[model samples]
Structure formats: C-alpha cells, structure tokens
Target: MTATAFTSPSLSGTEALLLDLEAERCDAMKRADFARLREILHPSLTHVHAKGQIDDYESYFRSGGTHVDYRQIDRSELKVQVLGNTALMTGRQLLVAVRKDGSGTVRIDSRVMQVWTEHEGRWRQLAFQTTPLAMSVT
Candidate 1:
C-alpha cells in the first residue's frame, strides 16, 4: 500500500521554527525530559488540558502521572497560519501509549491547537489546547 501525502506550508520563519519546536516537544514528552519542555515553552505559557484544566508552565512540569511509553505519534491535518509575530497551529495527533505494566496499551487520538510567538529571535509556545477525538465508528 502506498502512503498518502500530507502537506502544510508555513508562511514565515517564525512558523517554521514553531513546527520544529513542536517536534522537539513531542520527543521531550516521550522521554519525560522536563528541560526540553522548559526550553520550548514561554515563561508565560498556558496549557489547557483535554479535561479543560488550565496549567502554567511550572504547574505542568510539577504535575506527575505522565509516565507512558509512546510507541508512535502520527501528526496530520495540520493547518498553520501566521499573523504578525504570532503563529497558530491546529492538527490531529494519534498516539499509542504503553503503561508501565506488562499487560495492555492505550491509544489516544486528539485534536490540538497551539499558539506560538517569536521573541528575541526565538520561537516559543505561548498557549496550547487539546481535545480528545471521539472513537471512530468502524
């Protein structure tokens, strides 16, 4: 079977940088590396969870219970738009997570929207919101 092609074009350098930063953020999350998250997130960053909880950068790093082995992350349906120094990214993500237990695994599909800003020649995530996608009716 041939893989389908997906494309999302970025308009400016800031938008491009945000895409790279987001990739790094995913890698950091998979490794549970807080430092990487810190580097990519703005000091005033706000993260809205799937459950509608709001957390600041420090709070997010402090909250535990994030342990999971990520088998795969599929990011698609990306739409990036730039307005001045701010860029907005919306996409769908499919991630497979394996618990510490040797028993079973869980798959999560979500739609995410993230805002990024350029400050001092660097791009940082200013805000992020994610919502869980309903299961597919197959």
Candidate 2:
C-alpha cells in the first residue's frame, strides 16, 4: 500500500468496506450474479454509464445484455469521505473485459465516484458515476 499523508479512522473503515464492495461487484459481474448485485445496491440506486445512459436498479438488473467477461481489474488511489450515515468513495480503476466469442478484448481505465448510505445498519450503494480517464501524451 502506498503511503497517504492524511487519513481519518472513520474514512479508513469506509474505504475498506468500499473496496470489499467493489471486489464483490466485480465477482458478481463476472458470474452475472444479479442477486448479489441486487443486495449490494440500494432500492433507489442509480447507475450512470460512461455512455451518458442512466439506469435505475431495476433497469440495470433487467438489461441482460452485459455479457462481457471481465478478466481483471486494478484499483488505486481510493479515498473515502464519511458524512453522518453517508459515504462518498472515489478512485481509479482499470478493467479488462473480453467478449464471449473470444474474438477480442476491451480495456477501460476510469475514475469512479460512488455514494453509499447506511440503511438499516448496512451500507448500500445509492449512486455511482464513472468517467473515462484521458490517456497521457508521453
């Protein structure tokens, strides 16, 4: 783990939980486990796609067209901010996905921000937004 200059104990715990959630989400995506995804997401959650499309929890689960198999994901520079019962998580993620046909692969590197709220003593994702990171010109 890289050293961070500033840290908060509460934020640390939130960050840990968010990281765990991200891992579980990745697993669910790989297995197309809608049930698990449903559990993690709040009832009124909204997911904003990179393509300017917005999906509510119900719509996202019903899409059924997200069949890409994720090969791996790399996450870094995560920060969590806690406000009362809500938390905001921000980070960078690199994801590699392959089509089921085995024809090719797609890689995406993006910056993500997610809002999670504690409901009934458990945290659930309320909203998530992601933006593709611009490649650096070396």
C-alpha lDDT of candidate 1 relative to the true structure: 0.72
lDDT of 1 by residue, 1-138 (tens): 001233235345555556667777777777777887788888898998666889897887765225456666677776678888888899988767676565567676899999998867877889988788953311
After superposition of all CA atoms, the RMSD between model 1 and the true structure is 4.5
State in Å the error of residue 117, model 2.
0.6
Q: Rate the local accuracy (lDDT) of all candidates.
A: 0.72, 0.74
Single out the weakest 10-residue window by summed lDDT for candidate 2.
1-10
CA shift of 48, model 1, Å: 1.3
The runs of at least 3 residues in candidate 1 whose Cα sits more than 4 Å from the true structure, single-residue gaps closed, are 1-11, 64-66, 99-106, 135-138
| TM-score for each model | 0.76, 0.77
lDDT of 1 at 5: 30
